[model samples]
Target: MTLQLDAYMHEKKAWIDSQLPLFLQETSIPGKLKESMLYSLMAGGKRIRPILLFAALNTLGESEDKGLSTAIALEMVHTYSLIHDDLPAMDNDDLRRGKPTNHKMFGEATAILAGDGLLTFAFQIIASDPALDGDIKSRLVALLASAAGPEGMVGGQEDDLEAEEKVLTLEQLMSVHRRKTGRLVGFPLEAAAVIARATEQQTHSLTGYADHLGLAFQIGDDILDIIGNEEELGKPVGSDLNNHKNTYVSLLELEGAKKKMADHVDRAVVFLRKSGFENSLLAQIAAFILNRTF
Candidate 1:
């Protein structure tokens, strides 16, 4: 399953690489700025969000060519988030994916510019794609903006910073993670529905599925923070503790967090079943999320 997922991910990775530059290269930025932005944007991660978007589109019977714009755009937003999160004002990390972080290599100012460029370019990538109808493109643009904006991913990040030294209840912790991380995951599922012209019912089911996947992914990340090593994770472990940000596993205790993740995975499977996602690869993807150490 890992082999299959890895192979599939490679295909999407190639697609993203070829198209991502088109978005950033046209921004009229200096050559070096574009280089730093491209460097971090091209750096390897799971590519999970873009892959999930493509997988959802595939099951909806959309062609990859038609989905390419969204696939790349979502990846840009994700990469932008990581570049900013690794900044000194945020995670203050020096390493990511076993390389110097964006700020470390580019200086804080350039790194900030690169991230801003990526974020703005993500919308442009989606807006300019000829694959989607004007109405659908508009909808997706609004969807992404809201999901990544103050009400969603950014809001969650702020909450995390404020929760420092505060003992978050399980619900509070869930709130922080669901937004900071979960909405970004959910956006792809919703995007697939929009692109495929799915019915309201199907969209609803897919959304629930995405929500479960998103939250479960966060729980697994929490567990990794406790058990994972920095070399394996490509970042420092226990930084969450050092930063005093609450996580699902942190609040629940590791045993309880494991149990909660089990529940989440099960619920996600149920939603996928209802949505008729019979793809074995997605099933294996579920297991990967549950089992990943970094």
Candidate 2:
């Protein structure tokens, strides 16, 4: 079945697949490390983040080709985060997306460097995007940096680490998820609207949608951790409880967690609808986030 997305996620994935190798062409960097980065990146994901970026931009109804660089940049940033997340120092997982994780295939040091390389490369792509005005690109870079940097994903991760083996309040748990998950997820929405010159009102509305989507995605992941089959998930299940990482869904009853997730899903849909988005595919993607079994 074709997955619905902004303009179509399958199309975005296809475009990204074609663009990634071309962008990965080596210059000064050694081919080996570059290959390692591409190894995990190309291994395939839902590409949800980048597709969200596309939808966010498309909502402006501008048909410019300028959004492509930002789209790819977001994916690179996402890929780098995953590489680091799966390291021995972090999640320490042996498998990812039905394949050996970067550390397992390329060794931990190389995997770390590869992630670094991708992070730097993502900035390069953003700064060099010709389709967007330089000022807008700069703002996009800043917004993205905030999400990916210490105050965003990195900071959230720190919170996650500290909370482990310690009891946490509901607010603390949510704070961790917001920074860890919300910042990265927010990039597409912010970047898209910023590039498209959306009004402040529109940008703020999209932010709400992004926040809801981010929370919902993490909640779905928590549910999957308990109920997903190993073969199906391509990773171990119940790892959150196993790792003792506190998650909102973990602290709540199953029914309560499901209700919270439903609330988030409904809010996301409501925000998107109110924003006057005409994209049926974007609407469907929101539904998919709520409906996905995997």
Candidate 3:
């Protein structure tokens, strides 16, 4: 199953990488801005969000290609977030994807603009996608906006920053992660249902799977921060500790954190099974998130 997943990820990542450049090439943005945007966008990572979008579409007996526009926009939004997250004002990271962060390479101002460009262009991509129905495109655009907006990922980030100065209880930490990470992660799955016009029951089931999966993914991230290798992580490990952040590991310890992560994955898998959509691929993807070391 691991080997199969590796193959699947390799193929999907290659497709994402290949198409991303085409989107950049078509953009009319001026020289250095375009370069800066491309630099971070091309920075290598797991490409998990876009893959989730594809996987969700696939689980609905729909072609993954049907989700390509949404997938591309989703990756753009994710990359934009990463670029902003690494800024001097945010997490203040020095490296990402094994290279200097966007700010380091392109100057802080340019990096900020690059992130803005990606965020705006993502909406444009969704709005302009000719393949999807107009109603579908409109709904997707709204969903993506809400997921990336101040009330969601950005708001979670604010909470995370606030938490750095204080001790966050377990529940507070969970709320922070659900907003900061879970909502964006779940958006792909929800968008899949929207595109597929899935039944209300099916949508509800996938939403449950997505909710659990998102939380599990963040728990896995918190666990990895304590035990991960810097080389594999592409950024320094232990940043969470250095920042005095309260993570699942801090709250529950390593063994307890792992168990909690496992519990979420179990719940996610149960929901996936209940979704009844030939979800072998989606189940593997969920496992991949929990088991991922990097």
Best by TM-score: 3
Candidate 2: where are CA atoms >4 Å away? 1-7, 278-280
83-142: candidate 1 lDDT, tens digit per residue: 999898998988888889998898999999988988998898889998789999999999
Off by over 4 Å in 3: 277-279
lDDT of 3 by residue, 56-173 (tens): 7777878888889889999999999999999988889999989999999999999999999999999999998988999999999988888889888999999999899698888899
| Model 3 steric clash pairs | none
Candidate 1 global CA lDDT score: 0.84
TM-scores, all models, native as reference: 0.94, 0.94, 0.97
Ranking by TM-score: 3, 1, 2
- Candidate 2 lDDT over 1-294, as tens digits, reads 233343377788788888887777755679779789889889888888877777676677755366788888888989999899999888888888879999999999999999999999999988988788889988988998999999999999999999999988877777898999988987888887888889877877788888888898888888888887787777888888888998766788667777888898788878877767634455566678876666
What is each predicted model's overall lDDT from 0 to 1?
0.84, 0.82, 0.89
Better of 1 and 2 by lDDT: 1
